[model samples]
Target: MFKTHFHSFAIALLLALPVAVSAQDQKPEAPYNAQLIVRQPEIGQGSPSFVPSPQVRGMKALSDGKVYLVSTDNKQLLAYQGNRLAWKADVVGSCPTVVGPRKISKVLLGPKTILVTVGERTFAEVDTATGKVKVADGQKG
Candidate 1:
């Protein structure tokens, strides 16, 4: 009787050992799928120079490493090389119409051109090399 009971207990222990080992070896679920991208801020010598313009509404970086910023106050645009302001130009023509408190909404940088949109109505295509406003089109809000 004693030997029979000992053999039955041994079989039960062996079966339970495998289950406990596997339960301990199981892995937890992985973290959620998300990626983070980091961009380094460019710093130059002397004080952190900001482009000498009124307000910068939007910005785009070109393939040639030039940065363009749009100024909404005077309906103008400015360019930056490193930390210095390279050039500035008026976007409006001889007959200036009110752009009506517009804010630059989007910017797309191309190989040779940059496109910027203001609010929902106005947009401009600029030459990345020359910092010239190639075209500015708008409609009433």
Candidate 2:
């Protein structure tokens, strides 16, 4: 009898998993007060050198308290819970230099997915949870 009850309970949990996951996939609602601030670069001593601040290529705040950020200098997608860094995923084929046109230019947040666009043509669909690239460079997954 205990084994039968345990099996039924496990089945019920499995059925509810999708619902929980789907709810977590939704984007954050309006009145989002999270501001993206790119501070001005500070110059060092000796000779004036230009330091690059955090330039937001794309940013998205989810309803599940996850804030995703992509900087112009770094071609990696960063996930943050509050001020702490949660995870980061590199944008496929992206270079570290901020000079070229190959950097991530936009980030679109969908109901169930996040899409990162490079330049004007390449699009990478990234997973919200694991930061994995599901589809890249317009390739179907």
Candidate 3:
């Protein structure tokens, strides 16, 4: 009787273990065209609000739940953990445009960095944690 009961309990525990582990191992949803609030007042209005100018120029999500992006108007590189903003930096020399020939094309994820590209060239190498941007030669796409 003792042996049978022990075997049944062990089997049940093993079957339920996977579900429990998977639930805890799930990652947060990656950021994608998420509307982020800007502190800048639009047209010198009452208060700072979400504006259409500083849109998400490019975004890249990592497997470790980090999302990196570039702003449309100022070309600011931003990093996010889960839904919270981690850090931000100015992407110097980045040519960002909404309706022009030279525009921000895409964002790529590196080993520990994020690459901001325009047209068919990479322009910035941003650190994943500190949001430090190192200007790259616009050679590789």
Candidate 4:
């Protein structure tokens, strides 16, 4: 009876090992940054070529866990984690209807912050964790 109980206890400990290990192995999700535009560098005829497009947006997901929705080319940015919307915010306010073309000129990333520049005058500061939007007015970006 003693040997039988010892073997059973060993088997029970082994069965619970994975659960304990997995709990300790869990890590907090890190904020991810993705570009609305894709830039490819290629060698053409022994020369370097760098190309960028405004309308073409791409997604590279290992699985369908995270999905990003970009509104009006690159004006607004949204991110969905799993089946829920992780965060949503207007990246660059509504561009003029008749002014220069609407485009994201520069994207700056800092600790827990994301800033997007539109044209030469508009700047948007977005919270990376919660997707909060803060438009900088009369500020040079």
What is each predicted model's overall lDDT from 0 to 1? 0.55, 0.59, 0.57, 0.53
lDDT of 2: 0.59
Model 2: per-residue Cα lDDT at residue 78: 76
| Candidate 3 lDDT tens digits, 85-132 | 899876645434223234445555656776665544446677877887
TM-score list, all predictions: 0.45, 0.51, 0.45, 0.42
Q: How many backbone clashes does candidate 4 have?
A: 0
Model 1 whole-model lDDT (C-alpha atoms): 0.55
Give the lowest summed-lDDT range of ten residues in model 4: 43-52
Kindly list the per-residue Cα lDDT of model 1 for residues 1-141, writing each as its tens digit. Answer: 999999999999999999999999986532211111111133432321122233433333424555555554645666666556677766543112435445555555566766665555576777867878787777676
Number of clashing residue pairs, candidate 3: 0
Which candidate would rank higher by TM-score, 3 or 4?
3
Clashing pairs in 1: none
* Model 2 lDDT per residue over 1-141, tens place: 999999999999999999999999987643223445222223332321111235343344434456676654646777766666777888746432233356676666654567776655677778877877777754332
User: Which ranges in model 1 have alpha carbons more than 4 Å from their true place?
Assistant: 1-62, 72-74, 92-100, 139-141
Top model by lDDT, which number? 2
> Once superposed on the true structure, which residue ranges of model 3 sit more than 4 Å away at CA?
1-60, 93-103, 119-122, 138-141
TM-score of candidate 1 on Cα atoms, chains taken together: 0.45
**Candidate ranking (lDDT, best to worst):** 2, 3, 1, 4
lDDT of 4 at 109: 44
